[model samples]
Target chain A: CTSPCAAPFERRRPGFLTLGCRGVSTGARGDPHSEGKARRAGRIAVCGKACLAKEVFGETLNESRDPDRPPERYTSRYYLRFAFLEQAWDRLAEAGFHMVACHSGCAAALLGEPSDDRTWNSYIEYVFFRS
Target chain B: CTSPCAAPFERRRPGFLTLGCRGVSTGARGDPHSEGKARRAGRIAVCGKACLAKEVFGETLNESRDPDRPPERYTSRYYLRFAFLEQAWDRLAEAGFHMVACHSGCAAALLGEPSDDRTWNSYIEYVFFRS
Candidate 1:
């Protein structure tokens, strides 16, 4: 993941708002604790969309940023930050993982009219396989 | 999971709308394939709330149910069914899993006024540990 992707966690934002890709260690076929034997899988599952965050948060998202606070720890009650799909693709590509499958859609209840582009469609899930 | 909880998958709803609890098998500490060595973990992560689904889908949610379709397979374009938190608690308790921790809150952007209760808070995440 890139700097932007790690920014949320590095800053220790509230658990709910720190929407970022997480790596899950799936033990390899051999010894469980052997070094380099575990296959780490990165799942960007059901992450909030940047576009939707911007739409919903607007100016409050920017106002919450504080330069005085240490990067290692910070908290906010207002901002909701999430990465764009393009960023996820870029970071995974940088890490040499190829997209195995990707699915993007929103709930029927959140869908807007055919003529109306603004919708509440909020999340995207992606599965990437390491090459 | 109860009949209502299994109804969605039993009818083979569209992949996105099948917002039901799923059990993931985490290989047990010993043998990976041994009969009783695998522990199944049920995660009801980031599931849509029934209240929000009702608020959004309204009449369409009920209209999507069909009496003639076989229980094994069916699909719908209109329904966005999700279980209430109470239902999840009941199911997990019945399955012998105790609540390890649960945190429920909406995104700051989705939060309504202190006086306004009809907010767009859409989802809830729950974590349960098997005994």
Candidate 2:
């Protein structure tokens, strides 16, 4: 609708999303071929709490520039890298996805415990497929 | 509640499940401290079409016994292995998941095209967290 959400090749189904608040934008952003089609062809994004972010991109990245201990690098701040992102890309590739983009942002932890006073940095992914 | 569905830490809210057909058992399986407390304490599962499967585990596995040409190895059969799954585990780690399991099964392509004759082999992942 208003850049609230998007996915790779959502246009293939057209009506897969019906929510007025959240659905594929059928105008400019809706058209995956509008621009950057060559690189950003078909991208899918999945965003949730920090926990889900960790589940999708929270790993002691092999290519991480930071070198610390604690399995996943227990640093002072929350950070994630492309440690196993290739797996996600590989998985989406089967569905014809040629590219993916990962993003992390802060949001109210609606699913966290009541005693905790912190926001969750939701990890999101953009999956893309080509024509 | 039947074993048709399950998740990690769903019991934290007790009444989070309201469905009569697909919800937590709330009895034996509901307790995370069961006999497998030492090993199978926390687990989560995510299953969907083969396309989703390839997104999660599809990669030229570093541990794959089969070595081929394609970037992901254009094998003769539908297969996937752990490559970037660690990223998923890391993402969920923030949520307290300690382990993850991946599974693939065949199911009717409820979302595929009408002309396609093949069933979709859904890829599933079981995520676990320890108390």
Candidate 3:
């Protein structure tokens, strides 16, 4: 998975390269299997704008299962790994790549949420140039 | 200011264009002149890692001025205008551009803060392609 994933980036140099991935919560705590079971059992229901997650991933929130919990609280997908932007920048720097640009949190705006500083930091993109 | 600022973007087409700006706090409230005066008078002091703001902008926190307040609470620069990412996307789309990438919040990591979801959303960059 690592080599194939990195091949394209290594092959291109002295050229603009853009890379990005979905941001996952570093403090996410929950059991995906249990969440899936609960969702399948209809114990989970989509809440508020979090329905965007369901629309994109076919996943439902556990809000109905626990009414007292905040609506924003939800289980993250277990398979997705969180990416550390700082580490990525370090590695890229080591590879002689300089950052041309970086952006994050626009996904919230794309999903029709209010365009504000409070936008979910759920996606990140970086543009790098190597020479 | 508007025409000169937009000239470069309009001049380039069918090519990669990356644009970015420092992100400002949307809900920031306070007077910059007063904050500067307080800092110069030593009524304010740098608190924790927020000293990065000082290193970059010569600004200091009001922690000493109001020890009872949270250290994270501070006045923002009054001259900086907040940009709405959604509005930018809309305008870009209307101008016959399509987003190639977007990223935000990496400034926290660059300043040696813990790279996590809680990174400050203080910068945004977007790469667009027109064709």
Models, CA RMSD each? 21.7, 22.9, 20.4
TM-score of 1: 0.22
Q: Write the per-residue lDDT of candidate 2 for residues A1-131, one digit (tens) a residue.
A: 42212222344211110000011111112221221100111222232222222333335322233233332222323333322232443343343333322222212223334332222222233333333
Off by over 4 Å in 3: A1-13, A21-82, A109-122, B1-131
| DockQ of each model vs. true complex | 0.02, 0.01, 0.06
Evaluated against the true structure, the overall lDDT of model 3 is 0.33
Query: Could you arrange the candidates by TM-score from highest to lowest?
Result: 3, 1, 2
The per-model lDDT (C-alpha) reads: 0.31, 0.26, 0.33
Off by over 4 Å in 2: A1-96, A110-123, A129-131, B1-41, B50-131
Residues A26-72, candidate 1: write the lDDT tens digits.
11122222111111123323223342233323443442444243323
Q: Which pairs, if any, clash in model 1?
A: none
**Candidate 1, after superposition: displacement of residue A6 in Å?**
26
Question: Please, what is the TM-score per model?
Answer: 0.22, 0.19, 0.25
- lDDT top scorer: 3
Mark the regions of model 1 whose C-alpha exceeds 4 Å error after superposition: A1-42, A45-131, B1-84, B105-119
Residues B1-131 of candidate 2: C-alpha lDDT, one tens digit per residue = 32212222343211000000001111124445654211111112222222222333345222233233333222212232323444545544544434422222111111122332222111122323222
Residue B102 in candidate 1 has what lDDT? 30
